[model samples]
Target: MLADIRSRLGGVAGINFGIGGPIAHRIDHLLSGARAGIAIKFSGENLRTLRDLAEEAQTRIAGIPGVTDVAVESQSEVPELGVHLDRERLARNGVSFAEAGLTLRAALYGAPVSRVYEGRNAYDLVLRVQEVAPDSIAMLERLPLRTDTGALAPLSAVATVTRESGPNIISRDQVQRKIFVTCNPAGRDVASVLADIRDAIDPLLEGKVGYAVHYGGQFESAAAASRRLLASGLLILLVIFGLLCMTFRNARDATFVMASLPLALIGGVAAVFLSGGVLSIASIIGFISVFGVAARNGIMLINHIRHLQSEEGVAGFEEAVWRGSVERVVPVLMTALTTGLALVPLVIAHDAPGNEIQSPMAVVIIGGLLSATVLNMVVVPALYLRFGRPVKNNGGAAGTPGETFL
Candidate 1:
């Protein structure tokens, strides 16, 4: 759709499109506040120099692959008429500078002289000299000004009018004038496009004084959010590990359960790779949830093995392991099957509306469930049997003679 729209707008300048849904647009607005594309801000003391630098940067960025809608954000040369008042000429005409300025203003822009009352409502009566047109410089030059001596003089005798251009609006950051050279990424990611822009512009800014460049908008927001999410993910892992330790009351069992986390990762990462190779926030969240589920399955299996020995008086360690795993296989498979089946639709309709976040999450979860379920049932039990301590029954030591492995 965006490509079709861009083609339809052929030859039209200063217009561009950004692809985003309502929820994504709102989230982006909250993150960057009206900045729709990647923005490179150039700041300096001189407005002309800043504008020039921005244009140069825009030109450099436009040549990079996958960059589109390259343009300067500020209007640096807006046309206007400039009026310069001559103090000496006003004095020679016996006219005060203030009076001459007021007369010229009154002629160009009407002055309120009186008010008319109608039905308790009053309207200001304005007075001004009539002209051929509102913006006619010839008419303005012939406008009359009254001096203190009651003499009339043409406004041109005391003022000079010229056509010129200047900035329509001057934007400032940290008290320095700033201009933004912005562009959108078309076929590539923002980070890759920005890397190319930096390489292109670095030489242009070298040895330049009183000027600096800063990246803003989506690039800035994504970098910040990535850092925060990384920290949060590490914190989540630590919290999960602590809870597992508290549950089993032994470091060995907790460490054994954490092995399932890597099993989940094997499938989750593979799923994301198969689905466009994009690792978004939703996929990371799915990984986190999968880790918890994997740990829960390990906990359930290990607890059952201990229960068979301590409570049910199973004689041999191998017998207890076999019986416990056989008993718990149904529950573990049921959990994985139910969750994976529920997410199958989301994985299939990955490009549907409102499923942008959910689809990637479902894909990761489903993949992780497959790997974690198979490995947790086999690997986790093996690790416990090899390295785990023997469980003691209410009567005495549980395992048969010569059968205790640890």
Candidate 2:
């Protein structure tokens, strides 16, 4: 039924169906996201070429997997009436083109020459040409126009009427002509679908100059968010490094804490994959959050070892590492368990409506903590033992804040 309406309306109308809830839609828009799963925008100077490209793209895009509801924006030429005025004839009759145009406008459109006020309302009083002849090509030709000589002459003497076709609307982007090839994706991740689209179209458009392709709608927002998140992630890593160095008072220890991030992320990624969740902005945020937790765990265990060596005078490196790991077992388990339990609802109900943004994050966090807690226990201690060599100075066993275990 909707397709029928669109076909009936032809090139004169456009429609877009919004997907997802109001909040999600707003976020998508703010991120410059796609309305459809796949949207390809072709921009160039020639409308005819752009139209052909859009049509060809529409056909090709529909062939790709998971693509459906493929539609190209309307660029079909619409039938129009063209009027050509003969300047010589109008000059010979001492009639200006403006005069003829005004007369024709009044005849065709019923010119509002006056207004009548009644109570609080004002009504337009219009005057129009009478239907003097049956509809025919000769009707407009036979219409009379008054000349400067106060004589009526047929308008056919001064003008010619012909039928032509033109685009119903011309769309421009950044002063260049643009046409859209839109498609919806089902049963696939947007990133995968977009990759396929690019792979399919890139070769065709590669050497073409002054013509460009852009992905719009949801892809737009996704790309923008990805770029922003990447930059933010870099800055976050820097901040984390700075804070760790400040707290540990040593570059090696700080670097060790940072190293655990990848180990923790591995489990998070695995969890998302096992849960059949796509990597989205929410997942990225979850990974970033998990990094902080992983670093915190490393700090807790390492700091505890240093405290034990300084206060209790533990002599062996292996022993100090073992005691530290055992002491932190309860705290680490409780922290990870509490966080995972809190997010259990989100993880379990990931597919529930309105949970699209939260589920991926919960899954990542829960999985990351599980791995990070375990790895921080074993791997961080091993790394600490290997690199955290004790420095002695000044004739006594003077340690750089427990740098020397003995």
What is the lDDT for 80 in model 2?
64
Cα misplacement distance, residue 192 of candidate 1 (Å): 3.5
Q: After superposition, how far is residue 83 of candidate 2 from its true place, in Å?
A: 1.9
Cα-based lDDT for every prediction: 0.80, 0.77
Highest-scoring model, TM-score: 1
Q: Total clashing residue pairs per candidate?
A: 0, 7
Q: Candidate 1's residue-wise lDDT over 1-406, tens digit each?
A: 7777667764676664455567756665565444456767788888888877887887778789988767677474787677788999988988898887787778777889999999999999999865435557777778788888898898889889777778989888789888877667776767777889889887877888988988766767677777787899899888887886666566676788888889999999999888868776788789988888898898888888878887788878888888888899999999999999999999889878679789989999999999999998899889988987767675643333333221
Model 2 misplaced stretches (Cα beyond 4 Å): 1-37, 42-53, 73-79, 85-103, 110-136, 143-155, 164-179, 199-213, 272-277, 341-350, 389-406
Candidate 2 C-alpha error for residue 158, in Å: 4.7
In model 1, where do residues sit more than 4 Å from their true spots? 14-30, 63-68, 74-76, 80-163, 186-188, 395-406
Query: Model 2 residue 27 lDDT?
Result: 55
Clash pairs (backbone) in predicted model 2:
32-221, 33-217, 33-218, 33-221, 34-217, 34-218, 35-218
| Model 1: ten consecutive residues of lowest lDDT | 397-406
Clashing pairs in 1: none
Cα lDDT of model 1 overall? 0.80
